[model samples]
Target chain A: MGMTIAEKILARASGKSKVEPGDYVVGKIDLAMVHDLTGPLTLNVLKEIGYDRPWDPRKIVIILDHQVPANSTVTASLHQQLREYANKYGTNFHDVGRQGVCHQILAESYVKPGMLVVGADSHTCTLGALGSFATGIGSTEMASVFLTGELWFRVPETIRFELKGTLKQGVSAKDIILYIIGKMGVDGALYCATEFTGEGVERLSIDSRLTICNMAIEMGGKTGIVNPDAKTLEYTKCDSCEILRSDKDAEYQRTIEVVLEDLVPQVSLPHSVDNVKPVSEVEGIEVDQVFIGSCTNGRLEDLEAAAKILHGRKVKEGTRLIVIPASPSVYIEAERRGYIKTFIEAGSVVCNPNCGPCLGGHMGILADGEVCVSTSNRNFIGRMGSPKSKVYLVSPETAAATAVEGKLTDPLKYVRS
Target chain B: MSAIKGKVWLFGDNIDTDVILPGKYLVLTDPNELAKHALEGLVQDFYKKISKGDIIVAGKNFGCGSSREHAPLALKYAGVGAVVAESFSRIFFRNSINIGLPAVISKGARGIIKENEHISIHLDEGYILRENGEKLPIERYPDFLLEILKDGGLLQNLKRKFARRGEV
Candidate 1:
């Protein structure tokens, strides 16, 4: 039977017919996730349903990144609940402290080509970077997966984003996505699948693809995918899994292309991810906080890029710069490269590996009327604490440079060649 | 239950799940406790002022986030009469119906309604009546979904379905 990449994968896993966008199908899940915050509730639900054993222990991954190190009593309690559940259920991966955000850890370790991954967190779309059709579900659904190893989905219409041209120096993939959001608006990709391809995407690294797919939720996309390539294979280390590309005549609901050769660093103004403009247009917008962490850009490459600009420099007085590595492995890698030292020497506060300050859980929360430039996805009101606090979404380079300057600036101005 | 009457509060697009129930409060299990935090992130003290049977009017993409059933549970516990949005996050919309909450979609909600305005929602009729007597049509719920809501959430509905199947 003829099939698109998504249809082929779902059909194999779900044992369903040729699936198309908007067609509801139920399939076995290749993977499922739960974290400290939501694990207890899921456990409680499972108990209520009287499921003595999980459908497959190997497919479940439990994590404690939301409040890593248990900063408070509540967080500590949440962690305990997760540990208990993982122990009882025999979860395959129990990532704790600095292990990194769930999405990053999954991408680094388990996510592979053609897998259907689902998590209880929205950013689970990060696994789409590995050519998996991954998306987020809720605790109850996760509980169901734990019981039956299966879930249902309605196929989504596919929107093709064709990128062309090489990115300019100091302009990262984050900037490119920000630019796309600027053009398409926050709701542009709502309820659709975003398929990235073309010359521009081919030039980006796997980590960069993770960054792009990670933020698909901001555009309201169900998930995002890129045709697996050499780089994707290298990153995932999946030699045995087959790599699927869109058929030459594959159908798409819509297509949009971007030329990256002349693209500048982009910034998404506060209150909405789609409220974007070029960095030059919003220069001199003073910032009180600068954060470089979250599943999106908290990888090793992201830290290295930020440290290169922060070396031997001091952050602007009155500004708080927070850098959190996405995972413990990323933290170790950064430490080995002395990136952490450079960041601290530059007057930045380095936090443990976790999704700190990105979702306003803990650390780096902005004060009322304050402005922060963050590398995380989503700058919606109260996203980082206090609805009055404004957040500007930008690339790590822009975030680092702005931390030093206390305003939005091009990182090229300070980066050493 | 007594006939609930209240005014409708209308909002514009992209009302995410985070706004309805902040991620920070997801730990709480009590629906009443969660009800107090509903929309706390956006409109401070929303729960404290909300009366029984008040309605929410919003533009597209309402209830989008980690499909915590708590979202609709909190809204229902807060005594919300019905929710009218232009569009909805797929899971949240389904969960609302599964939990017996009245969630309707209407294109004209944003243009005609205001925050804290007095109105009446006729669930069976699938329309909202404004103080000025303007009636806005809403998408009617499917028969199955309405039946599930009437039975008070999916778990109860599922139990009934299984019991009937067992007898057969």
Candidate 2:
């Protein structure tokens, strides 16, 4: 039977000639990942399972990007445990200040097209941008992967997102995804594979495609994918000449058509990614914080977009803005482009390359009753800080404008002519 | 074996793993510490209010997020007798099973479960008794999973199995 790129990759990886959605198959994992927070727990689970050594040390990666610099003694202990675990197990460790976030670092160093990657973090689906079938698993499953280097998966039904028309200036891939979430609602893509295609998607850069697929979880998708094209190959540095694409007769659970021209800078209102509204509709809603980071949109392009708006303008007083580069490499790139200087000059706090305020652990957490506009994926209650601290999801451009205006303002209105 | 009985609390769709155990507390190694934050966001004072052997019934996609085993660990530690959802996230479902937490996917469960209604789960019988004494049939868990739960978790179950086989 004909299949999409995702189906074909899963089938090949699972050692099956043909596999359809809903078929439970166990497959060898090409890449496995764990971050600082969960790595220790997974290692403990591995010990409990009586696996003294990792199945393949080279295939395992440990990233210390969350709670970088060790926020507290507990976090310090976690990092120390990860270091020991990596050293003892012979797994590759990207210590804090060396690599960026786990998702970005994995995409940069290891993820390849058509490979099956699993991580202990949910956003590991970010690797799907490179045409890989990447999904997140729990610590115990990760421990299993550490021991046996294999995982079980049910081929999820695919949802095709066909994009058309060119995106308007200042409207980014983040806006397009937000617009999709708004239309589909939070649970529309639940437990399904989301595959991006069409002309609009083709126009997006590799980083942009990663942004789109990274937020798949916000809509409850198991994983998201963009077919491996030149952009994916270039970003992934993969020389595998076997380019994967969806078959013409491939079946899909659902197909959605998004015209880029019909889209605008969108925002997911407080409480849910699907609670979306156009920037114009929510104009003037006050915001106390603006965050521009996470695995979703912390790339150089994302920083450049925000810097373009923050140039020569200071963040509004009483509005705290925090920017985190997704990876150390992206941080360097942003510095080379002077985005960091621009942000700093504009009074924005440039945080280290960690998932700091996005998960509400440390660094720029929102206060009670406060509202924040963020470039991160989810807007669930208590996501940014206190349960009462509302989070609004938007593009980096919108976050920048909100940081400057101290309110929900259309980024288009603030884009310099 | 004693039957686990509980009252069911119904929730809506897309109840993510983050809502179960907020990402901030994921670093905590102890299940009890994680349990304190279980459902703290969805229902304030959930840990304080939830009693031993209470069940959580939801529409779909229960426990969807980073496959941190802590989510189920927190729920299990918080005294969630079992989780009956229309569907479960892949990782969450597996983690639930590995941790010996009873997770069943029940069709038409949304209609039968009411918040604060008494229900008795008969694991051996593959059914739950509603407050009105109606028998709600459920999918029977695999024998291996039942044995694991009976042993309290995968670790203990593995220990027992290995010991019985004299492989240790």
Tens-digit lDDT string for candidate 1 (A96-187): 64356889889888898989988888778778878899987767667667776887777778888999988878889898888887887667
**Chain B TM-score, structure 1:** 0.87
TM-score of 2: 0.95
C-alpha RMSD of each candidate structure in angstroms: 3.1, 2.3
Residues A315-360, candidate 2: write the lDDT tens digits: 9998988999988889888999899999999998998898878888
Model 1: residues >4 Å from true position, as ranges? A1-3, B1-7, B65-70, B98-102, B113-151, B157-168
- What TM-score would you report for chain A in candidate 2? 0.98
Where in model 2 is the C-alpha error above 4 Å? B1-3, B122-126, B139-168
Report the C-alpha displacement of residue A249, candidate 2, in angstroms: 1.5
lDDT of each: 0.80, 0.84
| Candidate 2 docking band | medium
User: lDDT tens string, model 1, B1-168?
Assistant: 223367787777877777888766776767799999888767777877778888888888887655567778788898887788888876677668766676778887777788888877666777777888998887876666667667776555544644565621
Instruction: Compute DockQ for each candidate against the true complex.
Output: 0.33, 0.53
Candidate 2, B1-168: lDDT as tens digits: 367788888998878777888878877999888888898878877888988999999987787656678889999999999898887876788789878788887778877789999887787888878888788888776666677678777666655654576654
